[model samples]
Target: MAELKEIVSTLDAELDIKSFGKDSSFSRFIPRVYEPLKFDWQTAFEKDFVELFNGLMLKGNSTVGKVFLAVFPTDKVLERFIEESNSGDLLFMHHPLLMECGDPKGKWGQGFVPIKEKYIKQMKEKNLSVYTCHIPLDCHKQLGTNIAMAKKLNAQILVDDTLNAKNEYVLYCNIEKTNTANLISVLENIFEIPYVDFEGKKLEDIQRIAIVAGCGDVVDWMKEAEENGVQAYITGEIHCHIDNDYGKQKYNQIMEYASNTSMSLIGVSHSASEYLVHKTLMKDLFEKNFNVETVLIPQEKWWL
Candidate 1:
């Protein structure tokens, strides 16, 4: 068993962690978070990004021997692990510690600037190394967003309409050729969520399907399913628009109408549908001989 730092170093050499992104805000800081978990298994992050991301891809890599789970308030969370584990290991995370969208050159151009700054600043101080895989991890066929969830529900895949290979997708899956109510029941049972909006007129013909994680912004992807006769749609969240004529109430009414017209929409909270992506990933990692741990971040916000 190696110390926390040693394991990080090994992963650094292997994954080229140093080259993940230098100019990005987190480039200089994230490594500090991974240092402490090398030898100490007990000191790792529990529910945050590290645990979530590691859960998804831990099985694919044969080179990684072990991993320490660490949940850090800041980057300094590395201190907890370094005291426990040994070398030849590393840390992986969900929820990007550093992601900048828009303009990388402009101020606040980095994706999620404020959150990145707060976390990365602490990481730099702790001398820890961290890595995160968001969409890519979610879209892996063997261990992807739709595949994992679909398997649990015994859902038959209709299509994997991913615009990009980076986990951007609208996955269509069918439930044992059931009615809308039965399909909804199956989804609730499979995901353990209590409710979803089912607007399909005839559930009996609902043998085909479509679903996606994250904000369902890809209208084209959703449309493709409708074009192909997908009766039900599942997604992480919903989109609402309001105008003077179409207030919040009106907007929702229109949305309901929309749902009733074409495909039924099942709005599963983004994290709820995607949680297995990490949990199952972690299971695979543990099964693959890499000592791994998980941390789940609490949902700070919720829809009213």
Candidate 2:
């Protein structure tokens, strides 16, 4: 068994949680009927895991016998965790709130909805702990979401923070000579997804690639990748397809850029892209350091 405090401290320092800025995506868009906590997001994140609202969201028990890692605290996933786990188990996720990152094949998501009050009560009653890490995990060198994808693909890193100070979160890699079709096949297998949203020219020769794990429709990132001689760009969502003016504008810009640019855009899905970190590296970290059995609660439907 590992003490919850110890795990939090070790992870906080190792991941350098405080280095990254502005993870407060939840501050503005909280659920209309949010269960008013004794302490709000600002107060809750005062001491440790202080990326506004990133770490140790709830304290159920002092020590944890097992750890459940998830990409998001979706209602279904949380229900499963509560059912399967002991009172003292921990739920370590990438996000505390349920981020509705629209289904690739279906409609757009509701976006950053807070957990229901009943679920919060159930967790408190069951003595289940909740911990969240967002940006830090995304940008970490060895265990980051992007690096995990690069490692799984076996791509040689051409430009990153370790080798070049220029690139941090997004990785520019050199893959062994392969075409877009073969690379897509490899990615589908790696992330265990049915389809990947791909844009741009499907060429036969793809030497260099850019990888951004989640919500990778940023036109600037693609522009930079093009400038750096990247042939393909891999991300979770090439087009968020959100049902809003901003979303439409962003989508159109990304489509335009991808249409014009030579680099291919591949979206693996937001949840699956980030899930790799927890499944492999993050799982290893908990098992190795805490010596506790870790349960990875995956999103039921990657498309959703």
Top-lDDT structure, candidate number: 2
- lDDT by residue (18-105, candidate 1, tens digit) is 3433323333334443444343222333232233333222122223344543222223333443343233334455444422211111
- Over 125-176, each residue of candidate 2 has an lDDT whose tens digit, in order, gives 9988888888778888888999889889888987444433254667888989
Q: Where does model 1 exceed 4 Å of error? A: 1-91, 97-113, 116-119, 122-129, 158-168, 197-202, 240-260, 295-304
On TM-score, the leading prediction is: 2
The global C-alpha lDDT for each of the candidates, from Candidate 1 onward, is 0.47, 0.81
- Tell me the lDDT of model 2 at 155: 89
Off by over 4 Å in 2: 21-24, 27-51, 160-167
Per-candidate count of clashing residue pairs (backbone under 3 Å): 52, 0
